[model samples]
Target chain A: MNPIRKVLRAGFELIERPFDRLFGPALNPVAQLGALGFFFFWIVAVSGIYLFIFFDTGIERAYQSVEYISRDQWFHAGVMRSFHRYASDLMVVMVLVHLLREFAYDHYRGVRWFSWFTGLPIIWLLYVSGITGYWLVWDKLAQFVALVSSELLDWLPIFGEPIARNFIATGTLTSRFFSLMVFMHVAVPLFLLFIMWVHILRISRPKVNPPRMLALMSLAALLAVSIWKPALSQGPADLARVPNGIGLDWFYLPLYPLTELWGNGSVWAFLTAFSLMIALMPWLPPLRRARAAEVDLEHCNGCARCAEDCPYEAIKMVRRTDDLPFPTEAEVNPSLCVSCGICVGSCPSSTPFRRTEELKTGIDLPEYSLRQLRERVMDVASGLSGPGRVLVLACEHGGAAGRIGDTVVMPCVAMAPPSLIDFILSRDLADGVVVAGCAESACYNRLGVQWTEQRFAAERDPYLRARVPRERIATVWASALAASKAEAEIVEFAARVAAMPPKRLRSPLPVSSTVPTPKALQTERGTT
Target chain B: MKALRWIGQFVVIAALFAGVAALSDWPRYSQIPKDAGVVMLSFVHGADRKGECRRLTPEEIAKLPPNMRRVQDCPRGRRAVYVELDVDGRSAYRADLPPTGIAGDGPSRVYQRFVLPAGRHDVAVRMRDSARADGFDHESRKSVELMPDQMLVIDYRPENGSFIFR
Candidate 1:
């Protein structure tokens, strides 16, 4: 990772911890920026619909209709206008913060580039929707927006006739021009919604709405401010009189002022160059990812667990191409894979109890195979000499890397199957096994920690056996910057493991595990 | 204790939201200084063809095919347009706008704005669009009182007999 990105992620983690503690992970605003953007968009849409009910589109009646909403319908329609304005402003804030967050967290690189690239156009559509929205108000502020925006647009060679001519004087403006503004204010947002959908098209599951409680609280905040200060228009536009000082929505209109400072041509050039740079960011230095996971048809049972557990939806179940008895076989889409290795852990055939000379899983990463992982674990565990003799499986992107003598680094901690933990403890290779991964809900691979927790608790497939001592198995979740905290957790778990009574070691082959007793073989299925 | 923390977080978030929302309109922005006004000159007009039609010579007509024969031949290109503005006897703007299109046969477009002090001032605008380009074909001069933050627009319409000020 870049040093700048590391610092940014550390800063984001520091800011997120307090919010996470207060509101809980599900309701944290910093984590739910994309969802909050949707929430604000809906607020703006609903309120705009209500205001449109009383809005008149006529040239002479447009300003009066809005003024009437502000003065006569001060309580209902008036408040709705304020909601439309404030929520739109908040949407801009959320969109920008969401972009920065994704970039800082390194989510905009590799296979995730589709979402980031699509986001650039969504921004332009949003600004178009907002600027046209201001034009519909037909106030001095609207006039300023119209003239400045038109002049900025005219700088391009695409337009044969300058749109700025329409705003030369009151005589040049027409009712049809007002109609076009109204049409764009509505049409552009509908297109914006379409592009927003495309922004998340590649992800398996995307959060499009904030938590219910957070949404309600946001609504209340907007309403309180609406009552405190309603959105009112500036004096009606008079082309004969130049608009000097006016209240401006800094979120959308800040670019208009830039046109003045930098000149229209320079501003246009800057915007074009800036947008192109952002759009091409993903390929500026493409990510060097490990080889994608490959499927071993002989080991696969068509269970479909890997397909269901894959965070990127890169695995699929297809008809068996070989003479396998199962109806379906797992297939990997290499383009979409991030080489996380969660699929290997999810495979039922990934157990260490199989008396094979060389272990192989149904779906496994080529660079970091299950065989390499099992060998590393056994080697590290057998060398431990202390009383606790704990072996730690740590994620490279998370905490605990190089923190202990008995540690094995994997692409993700979830890559270690629960059966391997049981095998280590039962064979007396180590007195305890600890799996440490990225912080909860903040997994570098998105669902590693969640799946790992569930599998250990026996709530998910390929669960830990019932006979493994619960106290002997421990899990720690911490960010890469919190190495000390993870080390303390390891020490605490080791002490607990040391206090437990020791069990006789099961008979083991040098290259295989002994079979369990009948009672120990019985599975304990967790309630759904 | 958890409930108290929740309340504190919510209050802080709401306060920040309101603070930014207030900035949507508060702290007014001035686009231009109080004592200044703007003058905009904008229009689109096509100049006459660059060359006059000439009767075809006997040998030139004989070389043409029957369907392509014509009594006269004329150039398709149009002349470029030139414009100048004098505010209070000072040259404020001058430009020669070339015709648009691949063959240079389209209209020339212009949109320019300049700032001047708010007071009575003499303004002069001139344009030349014909073959004889040394002198102006159309001209307008006016002495008008401009209020602070007022905008005056200068436009052209041949049908309206030249410059129109608003």
Candidate 2:
């Protein structure tokens, strides 16, 4: 990592650590910032639908109807109005935080760039939709927004004459105008939803919504806010006179003041430039793509385990073309692959019992295969001389600085199959094994830390056998910048292992007993 | 214990929301002010005189595609109207009202407001509808008494060929 990025990451962690400490890991706001944005959107959508029921989209009646909802129905409809406004504002705040978090964590480059690039337009679309929603009230703020927006639009030479004339005075605006504004307020959100969906398309098993308890709490909070301070409109729009000043929603309408300070053209120029820079940020410091995974049809059983475990959805199960004696085979799509190699861990053919010339798995990363990974694990475990001899299977992205001896780095800790851990401890290659990777929620590969945890807990496939003592292994999640924490965890784990008695290993099975016969392997693979 | 902690977090979030809502002190529905006076200036400017195209001949129409042909080759563009207002011998407002709505060419309408003290004052308004640089196509000047919180309206009627005040 470059010095600039390292400093930035350090700064971000410094700011974030306090919140993690205060809120505890599970309730950490920073960890769940992305999902919070989605939760806020739901609140906005629900409240907006409620507001739409009482809304009157006519130039003359728009303000009056909104006033009626605000005053006459203050308890229900009025609160809903406030909820809609505040939730929309909160959504923008959360989206910005989420963006900053992704950048701070350096998750916006290489394969993750798609999510970042798709997110840029969402901010603008959200602003447009939110501004249109305010316009529906036809209040003083709406008048100011419409005027400034029209002035901005007029900056473009596409129109023959200035569009600002529409809001020049009373009676100039018609119901058709209000109708179009309402249409945009409705339609733009649906378009934004499509964009958000596309933003997560590259990710497998995307968590679009936050946890259930968090969602409920968020909704309750929004409701409480709405009831306490109902959303109210400013005085009705009068285009005949210039407004002195209107209360501004800095979240969505930050650019309105800029229009006043600098002319419309300069504001447009600044916004265009800023957006362009953000869109091109992924390439500012170009990152080399990780090696793509490769599949050997000879070993693949068409079980689709790798496809299911892939965090990037890079692997697909296709019909076997050759006479490989398999009905289907997993194929890795190079363009989508991040090469975290979690799929290699998911492959049952990745067992250490293989005595072939090369320790080939059904699917493997070009740079690091399961065979090479096993050899590294063995080398690290055997090399340890002291009594507290510990083998730490660490993620390359995880903040393992090689401070603790006997460390073997995998692309992700999930790339280390449970069998590998079993092989190390059962064979007495190491007194203890410690698995460490990126923070569970903040995993660079999304599901790497999560799947690793599940695998270690014996809750998922390729589970650590019941015979393997749970106390012999430990899983620690830390970011690449948090190497100190990972080192401390390894030291603590080594101490705990040292306190326990020596491992009682079962007699080793013969190669034939553990490894599947060639004919049986092909037949068993066919059923999967 | 875990469930209790989860519930406690939920309570804290709810309390935070209530606290923020109270602290914000947002305007209530019943608090809308009613004493402010509104001055309405509404008018659709007369059609542009410059760049007005003549009607196409029957032979010319026959030569064009069905979608392209129009019975009359009317002017596609309308000239903007210049409007100026003065109060108490001082220029108060000025704007060039464009022809039509945002999407296409249509009658150019303008609405504006000016809040003044409740008293009698001399008001003057002028508009140039066409491309002529000579003078205003229509003009109005008057001393009008305005009551406190009164709604004053200024309108133009092409049929009457004059500005109307109320």
Model 1, position A353, has a per-residue lDDT of 75
What is the per-residue lDDT of model 1 for residues A285-382, given as tens digits with 9 covering 90 to 100? Answer: 99888889999998999999999988888899999999978899999999899998999999999987776767777888898888888767766665
Per-residue lDDT of A319 in model 1:
95
Per-residue CA lDDT of model 2 for B36-133, tens digit only, reads 44455667665573476788889999999988998777656677778888888888888887776554366666666577766787889898888787
Q: What is the DockQ of each candidate?
A: 0.64, 0.15
Model 2, span A411-522: residue lDDT tens? 7888888888887777677878888888765787888887887887878887878878788888888777788888888889888888888778873864344333334444
Q: Each prediction's TM-score against the native?
A: 0.91, 0.80
**Candidate 2 accuracy as lDDT:** 0.77
Candidate 2 residue-wise lDDT at A329: 93
Interface RMSD of each: 1.5, 7.1
RMSD of 2: 7.5
**Residue range with the least summed lDDT across 10 consecutive positions in model 1 chain A:** A519-528
